[model samples]
Target: MRPEGIRLLPWLIGAVDLVMIALATVLAIRLRITLPIFSAAGDVLENTALASVFFLGTWLVLLVYSGAYEPHVFGAGTEEFKLVVNASFFTAALVATMAYLMQYPLSRGFFVLYFPLGVIALLVGRLLSRRVIQRLRSAGHFNEKVLLVGTPGYIGEIHTVLARESWLGYDVMGCLVPRDYAGLEVTSAGVPVLGLSEDVRAVVDEVSPDVVFFTAGAVSSSTQLRRLAWDLEDHAHVQIIVAPNVTDVSSERVRIRPVAGLPLMHLGRSRSQLATNDAKRAFDVIGSLTVLALTWPLLVVMMLWIKVHDGGPVLFRQTRVGRQGVEFTCLKLRSMAIDAEDRLTELEARDHVLFKSADDPRVTRPGRFIRRFSLDELPQLWNVVRGEMSLVGPRPPLPTEVEQYEDDMLRRLNVMPGMTGLWQVSGRSDLSWEDTVRLDLYYVDNWSMVQDLLILARTVTAVLGSRGAY
Candidate 1:
């Protein structure tokens, strides 16, 4: 959903909350036998219009101030409850404080009642709302049909994610794979297939998607990409969102503009990042030192185990290029026999398949256990601390891979390589070579801090699921 849609949800939620709070406040005042407006019924009608107004106004102000009425509350169970708890207490306290300062007098128990009432109303109402939305979307009554446009390599992955995520409210109408895509075949299921190479208007007429997502990674030339967008606007009465191909790069680090017929994209650390450059440096220094301090024990244990298990050093180091083509030693736990590298020649032609195999004869017993959950990557935190890598960015390529990079792919090396990045969360080794290059290029051109944080969040999900981990 768009951010605006999320904003709308809170308004509805806030309305429901206001009514509930007013009803509760009315009952609470009646229990105290001090009903101001209920006097019309000889304090027996149980009507408390006065307190109802007080709570309605108070809750409205509190909800707005606390950002309680936002779309995030729809999916936010505890988070929404936290905002409710805080807003409710603030309302009660504000009322009490105002009365005390004015010497109007009010009981403290009223304030105590606010907590349970607001929290319960907020949780139950939202839980029910969620069920309604889930049911509606699952049945396709409340969902959007989307036609994705991207290179053949990227379309399959996009389809896979959308097919699995039903709550996202998106139904895959079909995919438009770039006509120019020379490598990789499309995945089957979840959606129909369309031609990516055609003009946007033609595809729009055929698919009739409510929303159009144009993937930047599919096409390399900016001029052609812009023309495609213009054609889409001319052809369809649909909402269009441009998704640049970059995977790990954050938007905060990217800027875009039209220069003549070309779309020029600028990417780098911004002023905000400049301010935190020192902070990152400090984190690198402190976090690395802390890990080193605590892991010496593990290091000792692993060193001895590796000596007994595989008769090699526990630490595996490789020289990889870092920022500005600078070379640094990348560290990792040793997971293979010492001669595993020597066996590469025999597995050379099958390297791609070998890299993805769940079980491999080359992996030692301990190696298999550690690699399954990424314990083998723990030592790379040292490379990050050493300033040779970042928390998020394009993946570091091997020296041989770098030598084979095409002109367009060179943009990836402009920024520091990261220990974990968009590729890791998006499918890692399962991603085709073309898709990997496209994602890295997109990230390099569209770097931003928010994007980095999102990548980090997605990384957690990817890691826990062990999706494409090998």
Candidate 2:
């Protein structure tokens, strides 16, 4: 694949904004015509057509400013969505000012309603489009292929990285290590490195990768780095990426800046520390209560169905590890038999092959469906409402599970556990125990509110697809 393959990538974002802007226009117009309750007495010269064009321009500017279309960038995280929302408000305000100056002043109510509506629509549209794009990329369409080119150590590290980050969508065909380190064994899990670094150009010629990413030690000199770039130019389509030697420092803290005569990369920690205040707790409580209130009907129906089918208590509770390693009896709608754990020994004896059994007989008729779509987890909203959990965070592991954790695995307990999380959204039951650790660590390392929202949004699709569910 070539760089051109990713062209018009920006247009996909633009089209999403365009569609959302159109939707907002219709929503605004419908509100005006059909909802007398929302009708305003104030006069505004801003015509609907003009408003639409303004919104279109606003969305375009925001998408560009937000860097939503940056090549090879895809995450549902807060930074991405914050950009969408920030862009939306600025555009709305600009439009309102334009209206005022042109004697088309919009009512304050219209502006207030319009801004939220537009932002919501834009976010919803991006999320839906993200799901479709993720599906396509996961299925291996529209994803870039990379030929790992580095020293054996670097190659091995990168191979491990590529193997773990399946959502990033880079299919590592194989790796190319230095000739001195040739024939070295590594986890060729699925991707294998084809050749040595001595024949970098030959590797490029043979593999024709979309991007060539080199680690620091492989090309030790600045001259070698420049030469690699020049050699890649022969292909004219392959991109060159350089990974630095800096360790443990987050990307947020590491900023590359150009100083007098050198390219100086500065390091600074991210400013947004984990929010731990009464305000956030209050916000969580109110938000969860509102959601729980609205979804009570569905919850009642689900409870009834589970009770009728399983003939047991509707709610399940277990003392799981929580933030700061505190224990909390997390609540959930029971989606397994009362004696399901008792069968664990039997199931384990019957299968040393896989950790899960798709045909487990312990699940009741309705329990199976609840578990599949994760409806069984809905009762945890009470925990969310009670401040025992968050809307998004690391998953709370059972106390026994925590006891068995390796040093690295315990990193997952750094934050409050949530009803949904990166592990649940990424692959759920499909993930290997190792991959599960990797994802949990990944979220703990790079967590943000935006990342939480993105995880939550992706979770919806994952639940709908029932992929990797037991």
Candidate 3:
């Protein structure tokens, strides 16, 4: 069942949005009045109050039409912000059109100030609301209880994901398995088998889940699934979600179409188009130049420190695999002794996929400090500028590591290696080889400008905290 607290989320968000909109309108009017071009010389307060009410009511209506107040979208994802932007623009345009059509004097400067202010206020309000809701959800106050109806393997995968992503607000209560499986519990995934699939209705009645996630092969046929849905509909308020067998592919790349009453999911190819590649390159160039400009002084200081500490090269150059298995000169601030490479074979292997040590003896004192906060990686920004790497992408693998890669693992080579990537912000040296590869591949599949910006933002926090940094 839906949590009572969660049921009130839409109302809370709507109230927050309305107040923010009204405040933004008033603020816009006050700012506009100061400008000679939009001077409201008399009765400013009365006019501003009327405008605030009109704008708030119109904006709220637009927001409702834009699906901003939908329960499914509350306290999650970019959809809320996108909807707010759309509604704001639409409301402004409608107001302007109405004034023009009715031959009423409407200050263009007022809208010029209002549109952005309204959107920003609404977005900030929603962000604050989301934070509050997430805190409540984390404390188990507002969460949708999920019941899994699937095989042990599928249940395990779904359960692991839901558990890891607690912000998704799904609390997996238990699972219902096929009758053939005699196990009472799934200890590997930590989900108890509530009942068999045949008794799914009874289990739902007993457990009273808000959501039922049916994994592939959960039922024997489409007919049985329909019957289960019908039974649940009459019994309780339950949302049914069918989990497709696909993994890691984004919704942007998947298209569902009905052909002759059969729904078919078409998967788009992974390769980026020319425009996307050009945009990515432009972002990399701009980001690299900006960072270089800001950090040159710090870079010089680090260079001198490294040279004074080791009397060796300030920069370390190594051959690393780039896109399509091509070799590139990867650069980094030298963080180890001159003979660190010679000691690689002497040290115990940490992992077969990526070699790293928490406390390698070859690291110099300065190296330890720099590597701890990833100052050593600052030089890779040069590689990004050189076009051999990106500001964000998969972690570049060594030539030897690439040679050891299985066919599936080589998919990491499909995109340019990055200076800081999903793997780096997630856990740098502490991640398992499998997890590192998975995160990298996910970045490859789901590359977006927003994702890169988010990773860069997280990188700052990760570096400052020095978590999982060696």
Where model 3 places Cα greater than 4 Å from the true spot, the runs are 11-53, 74-78, 102-106, 117-141, 182-188, 271-276, 308-311, 361-369
Q: Which predicted model would earn the best lDDT? A: 3
Q: List the residue pairs that clash in candidate 2.
A: 45-104, 77-450, 78-450, 78-451, 174-192, 174-193, 175-192, 175-193
Task: State in Å the error of residue 21, model 1.
Answer: 17
How do the residues 161-261 of candidate 2 rate in per-residue lDDT, one tens digit apiece?
Answer: 66665556677777666656677545344446577766778888876788777865666577776787777776767877777766444455567788875
Residue by residue across 1-470, what tens digits does model 1's lDDT show? 23344336667676677667766665665554554532333432233344456666877788788977654355422445567668877877787787678765344444455446656666566555665665566665446668787765576666665665466577777677666653334445444566655556787777677777766465667676667777776544467766655544444556798898566777665232232366655755575577678877876676677778967888888888776677788888888878888876655353431244555567887787667666677788778776888777788777767777778877778777886787887777777776677677777766555456556656766777777765
Native-referenced Cα lDDT, model 1: 0.65
lDDT of 3 at 408: 80
Q: How far is candidate 1 from the true structure (C-alpha RMSD, Å)?
A: 11.2
**Can you write out model 3's per-residue Cα lDDT over 1-470, one digit (the tens) per residue?**
46777778888899998889878887888887787775554665565566666777888999999998888887555667778888889998888887789765556677688889888898779877876777677677678999999888899999987886677789999889887786667636889888888787899888888999999879988788889888887755688999989987756568999998667899877743321398889998999999989998988998999999869999999999998888989998998899988888988897567888888898888888889888888889888888889988888999989888988888788889888888987778888888898888777776767667767866887899898988
- Which ten-residue region of model 2 has the weakest summed lDDT? 347-356
By summed lDDT, which 10 consecutive residues of candidate 1 come out lowest? 38-47
**Residue ranges of candidate 2 with Cα displaced over 4 Å:** 1-5, 37-46, 74-82, 102-108, 163-167, 182-207, 230-236, 245-253, 257-275, 349-357
Every model's TM-score: 0.54, 0.84, 0.84
